[model samples]
Target: MTPPAITGQVALVEDDYTLVINRGTEAGVVAGMVFAVSSGTGQVITDPESGRELGRLSREKLRVRVFDVQPLFARAHTFAETDSFYGLLRIPFVATDDVVTIDVGDPVEAIAIEGMGYRKEANGY
Candidate 1:
């Protein structure tokens, strides 16, 4: 049988910084795990020839690491990729003309369980 799907949504945002996801220990979530939040306005991709809906392509808003977890939820935050030399904060990578922040109810997906590959290709394999 197939395992249950592990998916969640952004439940809250604290002061426009901290984000809360709806999955937690009950869903196999642990601290230091990364979750990706995608924008809701995803463009639907379709097959040109058959005119069949293939999938939705959405821009990932940002990735957050969970620092706090409870039975039913988790809190997370993200830090900008800083300049090592001068410690300057860089602009958001996915910056759009209008929005660059995580909004409540955005879809969140776990970034765990990278699949099989040539072992030599991975570092320290």
Candidate 2:
């Protein structure tokens, strides 16, 4: 029930469908923890005329369950799967689905943890 903290970034994704995150036991990451993975650099909104920065938009890419923990990293399984004929096609050679949403370098934060809000608005947190 510790306050939701910035855990880490997704460093890599194994071919076996495991996500390798930078946070680990030392950062309070533990088995059974769920992380809210971000889509990407996110969309940057700005003023059309002044070009002033308006805001950034981010979306929930996927949810992952941490099942293995190390001192420097953790391995997780995404809740969604890409396996249908369409899913399979996307997984192997496309960028039009949830599987494409998760990429290395995406932000990953523990969710459903104490202090972690269950729902997020369009604003990037």
Which pairs of residues collide in model 1? Answer: none
Compare the candidates by TM-score and give the number of the best one. Answer: 1
Tens digit of per-residue lDDT, candidate 1, span 1-120 = 433445799999975557899999999877866677888778999999999999988788876767799999999876443443221442323333655677888998766332322122
CA lDDT for candidate 1: 0.70
TM-score of each: 0.69, 0.67
Evaluated against the true structure, the overall lDDT of model 2 is 0.70
The segments of candidate 1 whose C-alpha lies over 4 angstroms from its true place after superposition are: 1-5, 81-99, 112-125
**What value does the lDDT take at residue 9 in candidate 1?**
95
Give the range where candidate 1 is weakest over 10 consecutive residues by summed lDDT.
Answer: 114-123
Clashing pairs in 2: none
- Give candidate 1's root-mean-square deviation (CA, Å): 6.7
- Assess the local accuracy of residue 124 in candidate 1 as a C-alpha lDDT between 0 and 100: 29
lDDT of each: 0.70, 0.70
Question: What TM-score does candidate 2 reach?
Answer: 0.67
